[model samples]
Target: MKWYSLMPGILLLGLAGCQNFPALYSSAKPQITTEKIEQLSEYGAKFATEYNRAAQKTCTKYTRLYQQGDWRAGWVLALQVSATNNKHCLDNTAAIQILETLESQKKIDPELLWLTQVHLNWLKELEQQTKSVSQLKRAANRKQSRVNELVKENQDLVEKLEALKAIETSINQ
Candidate 1:
């Protein structure tokens, strides 16, 4: 038989074996109905919107501090904001635990999965923002240190110049 013909035969055999698979369908009762699905979907949409808005507010506040040259405060605030945003994200392991709890209680709301996904994305963005804030602070610190060194060097030079002039006057006298 040709390779292509034999390939189709093997594929059919594999599919036939999977026909009686019970794992694809659960025998569990309290199956999720269309009504529950709709309710969960609505809940998830609402939660995502509200959670994102809160996260955006925190980000904006932190950004303002960053712009104002408050590196220390900005760095701390950025971390806090990231933590707060992380709490709201869907990808959190704790949130998965909560889902397990809900499932065990038979109180699983499909909206939760959606919430976890939304929160996960927000946390990622917050993390990136935090890194940017940290880098900016480091750069600012470097610039400040350089300025201080220059000021000190200028002061030392001025003192040496005054002493040299005084020595010349004594030699002449």
Candidate 2:
């Protein structure tokens, strides 16, 4: 009677062992479900909208400062605007591309990738220009320092020549 009662449990254990449990758990890669992709894409769109609004505000601030003759402040604001714009725009676009790729179950579209790359290139160019401008400002400061030193040296030479003339006259007298 006890053996009969344990038979079902033994059968269940045998069946479980026969099942391909490891194959179910092991995959080449984890895949995102369609629902999750859609949810994340929606979030990306909302983030882009918020970022756009923030970029507009920064741009307005930059323009205001520039017009008010505070150019350094304006430049700083402009850089901030550019970086923010780059993040939101690229993230939004990339999210769309990824969603499309996963939806179609295909490889990534190079054209869509290029679209994001172009914006990145532009940001790089902007950064390079800022660096160049900074270098020029530093060079100008160095040149100004040299000019000040030359002016002081000329004054010292003039005073010394006058003192030598006075000394010569006193000795002769």
Candidate 3:
């Protein structure tokens, strides 16, 4: 009887010691670059920084306006930044709609004209087709976001199915 009692105690002690092993966890975090649109945006930013100082300035302006909650100005600057070869505005979705609105109305800002012409002469050298680079990047980002959302929805469905299976197992038992 004593030996039997000791056996239980020994087993419990062994298990208690084994449980002290360090808990294992995932070592990697999800990254934005894994998403196609984010990768494209990064590529665009890198490419643009090589040639355009205006785009860099525009990114700074966009960040400032975004932080200040000046959504309109932020969008404008975001669009300008996206126009560069690097698509620096990929992170900001709100700016795309704002830029689209400004474009459809045929309302060009005299200030932008003056800034591009006199102050930032590099913009003047761009062809007419190149001017729409920001718009294209915005469109691409939107598409990528939609794809990401769909993937999330699918993952949620899988999780729900797993939960349902667990509930069924417990109920059946």
Candidate order, TM-score descending: 1, 2, 3
lDDT of 3 by residue, 150-170 (tens): 999999999999999999999
lDDT of each: 0.55, 0.54, 0.56
Clashes of 3: 2
**Candidate 1 segments whose C-alpha is farther than 4 A from its true place:** 1-109
lDDT accuracy of residue 138 in candidate 1? 99
Ranking by lDDT: 3, 1, 2
The lDDT, on a scale of 0 to 1, for candidate 3 is 0.56
For residues 1-173, what per-residue lDDT tens digits would candidate 1 score against the true structure? 58987998899999998787557665665455788668645644554455467855654554465457543223233223334334533233433343344445544344344544454456566556768999999999999999999999999999999999999999999
TM-score, structure 3 vs. true = 0.28
How well does model 2 score by local distance difference test? Answer: 0.54
1 versus 2: better lDDT goes to? 1
